[model samples]
Target chain A: MRVSVIATAGNIAGEALSNKSVVMFDILRASSTISTALANGCKEVIPVIDVEDAFALARQLPEGSFILGGERGAIKVTGFHLGNSPLEYTASVVKDKTVIISTTNGTKAIRYAAGENGRVFIGSLLNCSSVAKALADLSKDIVLVCAGTRGKFSLEDTLAAGLVIKDLLKFFNKNPWQAKTQEHNKFYLEETPIFNNDALILEDAAVAALRLAEYYWQSPIQGLLDSLHGQKLLQLGLAADLDYCSKLNHLTNVPVFFNDKIL
Target chain B: MRVSVIATAGNIAGEALSNKSVVMFDILRASSTISTALANGCKEVIPVIDVEDAFALARQLPEGSFILGGERGAIKVTGFHLGNSPLEYTASVVKDKTVIISTTNGTKAIRYAAGENGRVFIGSLLNCSSVAKALADLSKDIVLVCAGTRGKFSLEDTLAAGLVIKDLLKFFNKNPWQAKTQEHNKFYLEETPIFNNDALILEDAAVAALRLAEYYWQSPIQGLLDSLHGQKLLQLGLAADLDYCSKLNHLTNVPVFFNDKIL
Candidate 1:
């Protein structure tokens, strides 16, 4: 399980992610919101980068069958049903409805990772362990993508990545570096990747993520609050959202992107 | 003072480094070698990106007065005076001599940083404390550029950057966030800028660096050895250079880049 972490989707080449299963994180809200909404029975999520695009997608969906979601500057976009807050994504609110969401950073990341036929899974503190377990089972090289704030590194997303990486480290302990051949073909489908002698190589960014998350091993809320985006949200009177986003392993289901929708 | 860390010089816009002081770190060997040479009484070090440029610069200087030093794939370039090994830069060999060095990543980063009229300094674990103190005293926004291995994030450089950031955190303890206006004018000159209420902000990448370094607070050598580049260097029979580069504050002299030369 060789892993490389990209701090932002803004700088990565789509082809680099072609052979890797990408774990997309936007913990200040995107990942957490996606996980919460889907877990609450939201049918599917169509992520688009621009607000106009989201509205177009929403309009195309059958009326009363879809909900407008996401935010701009941490506040709910005008005419949208909800903001990027996980607390608003309750069963009563999103049940059996499609969510056409657009966010500042999160959805943009999902779109980028989904490019070049990438297998994308959305992860956050909410489903940290579940995501790790899924990836360990998948047995392929991984790229943890943090959807940073306006192309800048964000602490919350990295922490979420680190949490998953920490789990992967423990699961693959003592494994030392050899690239897996026929790697991509057997990675995603029903076939399990078997290794005679495997190495769990972590590149620099991956190692950095693990180290930072380990430092905040016991207090994830502190780590989230320390992030710039988190601080902005807190100052905007969204402490409840921060508290919700910081929960560790609250969900056992890992959200995977498939055919333009996160299911 | 606000600080932003560029994980590598590869992705940054050179203008972003403008109006700020730049601390370049290529801890594998480039930075450590430069600081060692300067500390050992080398007259000045000229950093150029290409071997051809090093030779061209050498031709521009008097013979026997300067030496060519650098590496390609961690080995001494053909006919070059030395490889990228800090242990070889003893006072006997480099003392009072001008070194026109070209390194794969280090000099490339130096050239990029120097492009936008930025004040640049070279730092490594060897002069970590000195660089921190110099930046603290400078009282301006800083961009720590890590000359990562082939434009990928290198653990050793981030660790070195973290060490400097940790010091700044201590030096400006309890200071909160406020951007300095007329900032560029007040910075880099003899005129000291006074702040009524200043903020010591560490952007996300900067904070991540501090956390990772703090995790290895008591085991820097282990951090270096764990780094991918560090491991590669060790495999290439350069453990001594690794040991030399990992020494914290081994030299108090902070080498400053002035008029295309580090002195």
Candidate 2:
């Protein structure tokens, strides 16, 4: 399909991005943590834009079913059950719990993209393969929405998206037969220069992407607290959830949003 | 020197531009045209934000001595002296005249950076070497302000900034500078990776910048009308003066802006 990448949310909110299958990415922590929690065994990850909403959601959850997670500039929120570190999201800690996530950049991006018509998959390098596979199965036009820091593009986020684009290209090549056998291969691939780079054979490029992916797959949320931007969050005392956000496949399911709410 | 880049005016106002050595680039035309106009032998180029203000300035100027020029979306403004095209701004047409100029993105950027302190120079690849030398001589904190199309960072502006950064690194290598330059010297040089990359070396970069500079350097007012953003100004029917902007010299002159005026 026609896959247009808006470098920043601000670029589209007031200008373009309408009726697109938006894939929102905040690679440093938010998206990675969400993917990890869901994969490990978390029930649902509810992303809130503000701290008040996060606490409100945690309070309303059925007692032990929910865990408060997320960061404010990388530090854990006060009185919260966890911080933003993905390492803390272990099988023992979050085996079957709902997660309340709130961060400065990621949630706001989700809120913004929620206005569009197509499916919004929480994307990151950790879940790049699965997300791409899901998109291929759904086979619809996709937009890799990068949740840039504030209103600007971030190097980390853009690179992560490059990974997603890279993966989708690979998926298309490996599954030439899946389309003939399955019913979900209806989406058309849009030719773009961003897809031409041959990073698969390059040792450094492959290692870098895989390392970044593996690092976040388990301790995804924790990765955010350590980043240049994440440190700012930690200094702000939003560190509790940092540990909890690091686990991979903690929830074992992905959270999809459409029109601003969980779908 | 610290380099701050503002993607658009929508993110901040003139106050945000206040107190910095700003290099404003609306590369599609304003900076290019302004640089071009000065290079081609124009009087001082006056940049006005509003179209009505440009018209008012035009009406007040002495007749036959001035020309009104600018554009709106690649088209000429009605009731104006000329359209926004570098090819049209020849010295024969613009010599010894006061021209009222206006444009969409470029002039707005000029207004924004002009409101700040320190130096404010219109930048584009046409004057890449000149802009770099000027910034290096000043050696103060610098801000690369891109007058993004509408309010988003287009591919054109960032690449242009990378070009300026590329030149600064080269200039640094030749200069017998003092200590404490290591950190910034590397940073200034690092941006060159994108500029020097084989993938981006195209005539569009230099030609676009040169066209803008030539347009602005010619009939100072007509040059101002040569930006894509300038076209937006023309469409609104705002025309400005050319007599105020001066000619461009081979030895780059650092336009110092203090007290709301470029020196």
Candidate 3:
């Protein structure tokens, strides 16, 4: 299957993502937070584009049934129940509650990708392999959308995308189908997956992302600490969030965003 | 000596490139062609933002003293003297003649960068080291502007920027300053180059560009041939131009664009 990657959500147009499976990555915090909340038994997550929308959605829900969780400029929004840190999204806090969230970058990306009629999956280093396996099972063309920081390229998001693409490639490589011969001694093709030599096109951004992943694969935490946004978060006293987001394959829910909620 | 990279010209605002040394990279053809023409003894190359401006500038010049050279959609402009290929800019044709040029992407980038009061330099793989040396000698903050194809990221331009940054780092690494001792057995500091530790900050895009250059340092030609733009040129039967642009440090003339002319 062909896989393409966009370095930021601002680079995507509505028509480009039509009829494709899209995986949104914001590994610095948002995607990881969403995956953690879902994996911890949160009923659902409503990702709104703005803080006003989050408050309005929360008000509409039954009292005490939903919590407002979001951040602005890497800090918890005024009057919000929780910030974007995945550490705060534990089972004891988020269990059986619907979360109406608004983030600076990640939720906006989800809203943008939700414009097209495609299956939208939340992806991060926490559930990269699970997301890759889910996409492979669909056997459709995939587009990895990186929720970069405020319309600019972010290293963490791009590296997470690269990891997803690399995992997909490895999955296909190790699970190649084998052909069997019949009693009549006639050669026949077995039921194989979609494998076209020319169909697997790699865009320039995708290649760059893959290279970035390879370069920092051995020390992802240190790589995150060295990134531009990572440094900003460090200045904001969010080192624990960085360490939490650095874990690979720590979650397996493979959260999917559908009908304004991540399930 | 901070270095920041913009993946595409669209990301740049009016104030972003002000008071900096701006190096524009369109390695596939436009910047390469401009450097080649200047190196081949052309009087000057005027980069215009539109084809109409190119034609107007040519008409204003004395007859037989100038030539209109440009391309639209990878093909030579109608009735122009040359296309956007460096191979077409030989000494015999462009020597002592003013070239009024416009391309689909490169000239637009030059125009955008020229809006601010920065020193604009035309850069490509052909003159990467020369451009890096020139910037290092100036000791001003550098901004590498990639002339991405039609508002999208192009691989060749980013890789070329990375090469320039890599060379500049090497130049500084090898030429460290030495202190002198006075007659009274006291040490005196020499006039060293700008060496502030925090001043040489690398943005995320700049770091990515550096990593890309390191990944493809050994096989630059193959790297170019494998780029998205390179594949398009091959389809258009312009592989020869790709070969010409792939040569690293082959030209020493660092063509600087000032006052509407590349000299």
Candidate 4:
């Protein structure tokens, strides 16, 4: 299995993720909210690219059966039933409802990754371990796609990717599997049991993500709080959302977005 | 002064580099070649977007007085006077002659940054400190643009940007200049003499670049030799170019690409 990471959706080529198991991360709220909403019993999430798409999709569903939810520029889109806050996605509000989401960055990333063949799993700190385990079980090369803010890098998404890659590395290292010699030799892990047991190739970005995760291992929450995106969220009075998204392994469900709906 | 780094030229928006002092880094060769050519007494270099542009520009110049040079896929373009290898731009061939270049990445970046107000300078390890000192003298907010290989991140260009930022930080710290409070506070340099002397702010990418530079400070040459781009160049029998580009402070000239020519 080869693991690679794309820092932002804009970095993704049209056919890069085809046939690869992809874990999409937008931890600053999209992934977190999706994971929370599904865990809270929301039926499914329909990610849309723009406010018009959300309204168009919601209009087709029966009134009150679906909710318009998302943010533009970090604030609730005008007339949206709920903002992109995970805490707002409670059982009472989103239960048994379909959420039509149109956020500034996250939904665009989902659309970008939905280009062709591949299972797109929404990941955040809430389901970091669960998503990692799922990827390991699939036993295919994986690409962690970060939904960076706009066309720029976002620290929160990258760190979330790091956390996922780190967890996946641990899972594969602990489980016995067939090893490929060239990949093992590149990492110089000849003596490591995991390398002997399984063949795993980590691209440079994946290795960098692991190193980044280790750098912030002592205080991942603080790392998020200190990020440029996190600071913007805090200024927008979304400190609670920031805190919620920082919790590692807080949820067990891995929300997979397939066929235009996150299940 | 605010310092920001763009990991790749593709990430730059049309207006992102407008009105900013842009330092373009293509450490694997283009920037290095331009800087070395100018230092070796080449009259000037015209950076164009395509081979046709190079030919068009050359036709307007005096016959036999200009040279068309550059690479298409790391190999010399057909019927060109020279390839992108800095060594090919020696004193005997390039000195006192106008050279038009169109490479895979660097020239595109120069054109991208040339959109509006602001000066563009070519940078590499050969003239890293020289470029940093020039920026300090300009006393303006700086944007370091890395001309990544293709549209993806090239480790060598990024690390070279890091080296330039590191040098600029040192220049500000060592010399007395007016300091901006917010920039100083963010860096937590409140008690430092440089903070008192000058105001400078680093964007997230700049901070990341500094950290990356520090991580590889011990052996920068090896870092370049091991980069994905460097490896590709080495495979193409361009080890000499890699070795030349890896040398720090070897040249004192700061080649500024202004008015469509590197002078």
TM per candidate: 0.90, 0.66, 0.86, 0.77
Off by over 4 Å in 4: A1-7, A10-13, A48-69, A76-82, A90-102, A139-141, A167-211, B10-12, B48-69, B78-82, B88-100, B170-204
The order by descending TM-score is 1, 3, 4, 2
lDDT of 1 by residue, B1-263 (tens): 78889888787786787778789898889999999999888999988888988898888888899889999989999978988898878899999999989888898888776657745889899998899999988888989988888878888899999998877766766322222222222121222222212567778888788877776656577667668887777667677777778888899999888688898
Write one digit per residue (lDDT tens) for candidate 4, span A1-263. 87778888877886888778998898988999999999999999999987997898888999999989999889999999999999999999999999889898999898786668645899888888898899989988888898887676666777778788778877755321122212322222112323222467665455445545655555566556546677677667666777778888899999888888999
Candidate 1 chain B: worst-modelled 10 consecutive residues by lDDT:
B184-193
Model 3: lDDT of residue B54: 82
List, residue by residue over A210-260, the lDDT tens digit for candidate 3. 777776665566546546788778668777787788888888889889877
Clashing pairs in 1: A176-A199, B176-B199
TM-score of chain B of 2: 0.66
Give the per-residue lDDT of model 2 (tens digit) for A155-262. Answer: 445545545555555655632112223221112111111222333121112222322333233433433432335444444543443333333333434458654444
User: lDDT per residue, candidate 2, B1-263, as tens digits?
Assistant: 44455655455556655554578766566666665555566665666666788789888878877667787765677887776554456677776665556887677677666664534787764565788787777776556777777665443455456456556656545221211133322132222222223222212122222222322222323322223333344445432311122122332533333343333
Q: What DockQ, between 0 and 1, does each candidate earn?
A: 0.28, 0.04, 0.19, 0.10
Best by TM-score: 1
RMSD of each: 8.8, 11.8, 9.2, 6.5
Q: Look at candidate 1 and tell me the lDDT of residue A110.
A: 89
Interface RMSD of each: 13.6, 19.8, 13.5, 8.6
Predictions in order: lDDT: 0.80, 0.54, 0.79, 0.76
* List of chain A TM-scores, every candidate: 0.89, 0.68, 0.89, 0.90
> In candidate 2 chain B, where is summed lDDT lowest over 10 consecutive residues?
B202-211
